[model samples]
Target chain A: MNEIKIFSPATVANVACGFDVLGFCLDSVGDDMVIRKTDKKGIHITKINNFDLPYEAELNVAGVSALAMYDAIDVNFGFEIEIYKNIKPGSGIGSSAASAVGSVFGMNELLGKPFNKIQLTEFAIKGEALASKCEHADNLAPALFGGFTLVKSISPLQILEIPSPDDLYATIIHPQIEIKTSESRAILPKEVPLSDAIAQSANLGSLVHALHTSDYKLISNSLHDVIVEPYRSQLIPHFNEVKLAVLKAGALGTGISGSGPSIFSLSKGEETANKVKDAIEKVYSKTGIDFDIHVSKINVKGVKIIE
Target chain B: MNEIKIFSPATVANVACGFDVLGFCLDSVGDDMVIRKTDKKGIHITKINNFDLPYEAELNVAGVSALAMYDAIDVNFGFEIEIYKNIKPGSGIGSSAASAVGSVFGMNELLGKPFNKIQLTEFAIKGEALASKCEHADNLAPALFGGFTLVKSISPLQILEIPSPDDLYATIIHPQIEIKTSESRAILPKEVPLSDAIAQSANLGSLVHALHTSDYKLISNSLHDVIVEPYRSQLIPHFNEVKLAVLKAGALGTGISGSGPSIFSLSKGEETANKVKDAIEKVYSKTGIDFDIHVSKINVKGVKIIE
Candidate 1:
């Protein structure tokens, strides 16, 4: 694909109780890219001076995904792709998803946008699968459609756009600590108590209610993780301290974002969001962990090409 | 407590994923009674012809609860209590809860309403403690109040009133076949899969959403039981068949009500409710089990004195 402009946004997936079932996109923390036609039938990836990437298309996840999609549509076009990697890989903030989504989105546009958003999302999952080895829809849904999205089902493929409350604000804190997804996945227990299962279900119901009613209090209370967090939180340093500090500072709720050293807090207003961000930073500083805070409203748009 | 009247209503606890945490009352399917003053104070019990109860007060669950309440107050109010049990005992329909709640409520009123509902509920639990040796609040809350209630914590005692959608309808079917509470409790696995736990949580979230949005379709879709229903349904004859029949007949969802032998179908309107009732009856006939159907709206009003 030549002269193609593409954009992909960051996403948060495996949301606590949602595990493989929920995700949404973030507006500012993502990647932007452009592609141009080349004489060669194969592939070439050119990373911008400030960014880094693989040289061969096959070695690159996003490139492979784009190639696969273009092949399916009989688009025999040689292409040169360039990427601006705004999201860092292994950040637990859907870094790889942005790359994959951008590739498929960009290639589709170059080929006259032959597919709909859903179709592009399907192709995006193929790209993501190359890295994770599992097709998870949580990241793709949000990366494709922005806003708060619920992945109702994956087999038959269903995506529902949850009613996003206007007052919702997200505060994400990246602790600059590394906890590989593989290790995080290893720590989770295969079995859980029946009672715990019930509690989790109850919270899920409450979460949905909070979303529908815009009841921020309920939403905060409901953003708990009984299954994954208990195990994964241990891997994240100062996890409890971070959570306590955030809630104590008036954040409605705090939880590990995706899986990891990075954690997130949800607040109802700008004041609370600011307070929550300050609280998290204070705790991280005590532990001497380098971190950055991103405070923004939920991005309703998933992917957009600026060029 | 001589020359006094006590009233208690039937309750439905565990409201699906809320197991042990949620409960609510039903006005039509509860109890009404009078505990009159008597010169001889040895705790005489009488089962009014119109009401259902054990012949002896000491043997009657409600009577025992009344006696316990009196004992707690440090007064020998040796009294004669008559019960009008509107809820049939051992029907998996909160019959014992009605009696226990009735006794505590009645005695509280006789004692000048000394204890609040919370205290009264604690006293009522003594009655359940007498029967099962395990203190449970599922039945007590609904019998004490009138609508959807949640017993969030037991040790420290915390309760919350949950907002429910107005369009909710419950169609209860009681097959003559009996499934003892103790037996039903025994079959559940002590542990469950973590993934199942997560799925249950999602179902619960969906349920809360349905209630908040008054979306009958979502509520119906979300009424799935992954922990209790899977195990408990096996004990009920034609469980799968009955559920299918009810769903096919226009009910939004169907599951074993509380334990089993009693199945309740959630419907959106009266038309669907009647259809569910008839469908269950048709299934029961094939199983050769006589059954009674109670088609009712979601009970918002919990407990109140008829006198």
Candidate 2:
């Protein structure tokens, strides 16, 4: 194949109590990219459809990811890529992950799939490291493989695509704002109280079990983030307000999506999802912050060949 | 029913990464109790079994738990009880939990089951508090509900029974030593480093997913306890040596159960469990510590009434 087009989904990391370990892909939000082989022996970004993302192959996640894949290949090949970004950067959703995952996924398909999902995810992490300055697979894992994922460890990159409840809906809103991932991380304390740590551990354990057992009530109770959310929510204008409204409006759980500006609520049905979205929107509307909202199911097929 | 009999199974708490939240019961190891209704209007302990456990109704866990249940019901009915303790107290094997749970369960059966499992767990916690001097349900919840249980919150007493892979086996060895729960607990640091906290959270999230997905490799990768085990292991002889031996013996996971003079290993099959038990025994035998070991499947039926 001379060229390949792929779509990579957006993901919600930190999943409340799960912190750096849990994340899930969203169906409606993503980035689409197309990669084509070129006579040139180096990877390059030919076009970007949205936002003034960097064009330098070494800087941009898509270009850097494609470059990493190219380095892995013994066969000499070069690629030109076009990116159609839909998930916005700095929105707490996995925008950069989509670009990074899409690039490698597209390149792998064009290269006759030499690398498996884990290797591809590793390449995506290198791309993420260039952007975030620290590597994390909470977003990349689910975006690359789809559905809910747990990063068992980061050193060897043990990633597992965990089973999730079938009928769950995610209601997300990205209020127009910018909160750098580094700053969001900086606000966290260097140490957590032992009591809070134990409680957080308990909630996270239950949350993982809830996903596997399809127990919505357990999920609702386990969505609390005692460690990160209490500190990070101050960066978002209406985090707790919107979260309370969403829960009151029938969301099973709600939290800051990844790092902030975007908040998500999970529900059992489409109707409840829409209700949660409206409730969150109701709170954000008073702030007069321009926001984008998406209600989507857990994307089971993460990054896929679109054409 | 004039008389009631019950068996409340032993439990392994903490389960490595889950601290005060997670546990599962054992099939063959437990405490048994019998409660009989009397014309008198108060709870009483008429017989003693296996240990020098207090027999005062207010002092003993069995009597205390039964008393708490009798107080819950408006109708005054006296009860007499007999204890048959098989699990040794202070061995970190939920001996107190079995006694507490057995008492409440036996009384509940005698009362024609007025309370549900949650309420029974609540009464059991009260009994445990009298014995351990702190409120916890890691052991009691699993002993009450069976299989694997996760206590997400303690204040409102939120507990959920998580799915367990059917073929799992637990191999446990209880060395003859006393490590008081209070002493085992007092040694933990008041605060933990952010990195260790995050790693612990990640391991816990993966462990929960492992139990759900039947992913044995994930379970092995996640059984690490960065928060509690390092400090608590010092109180137990041959902790690290026994652990290494169990892992080397093909056990899926091994760790200190509850607070710990006892250690438990989880394996995929009966043969592996036996091998793990023998391996753990080998290390303890060198210490010249008298110990007892049992191998059993996950107890699907937790506390149950007997004829």
Judged by lDDT, which candidate is best? 2
User: What is the model-wide C-alpha lDDT for candidate 2?
Assistant: 0.87
Q: What is the interface RMSD, in angstroms, for predicted model 2?
A: 1.1
Q: What is the lDDT of residue A221 in candidate 1?
A: 67
Candidate DockQ scores, in order? 0.42, 0.76
> What fraction of native interface contacts is shared by candidate 2?
0.82
Q: Model 1: residues >4 Å from true position, as ranges? A: A1-8, A14-18, A24-28, A33-51, A55-82, A102-121, A145-147, A160-166, A286-288, A300-307, B1-28, B33-82, B102-132, B139-167, B304-307
On residues A71-121, what C-alpha lDDT tens digit does candidate 1 reach at each position?
777445576778888777777888778877888787777778778887887
TM-score for chain B of each model, two decimals: 0.89, 0.97
Give the worst 10-residue stretch by lDDT in candidate 2 chain A.
A69-78
Q: Residue A235 in model 1: shift from native, Å? A: 1.7
lDDT of 1: 0.73
lDDT by residue for model 2 (A256-307), tens? 8998879988999899999998898788889988999989998988999888
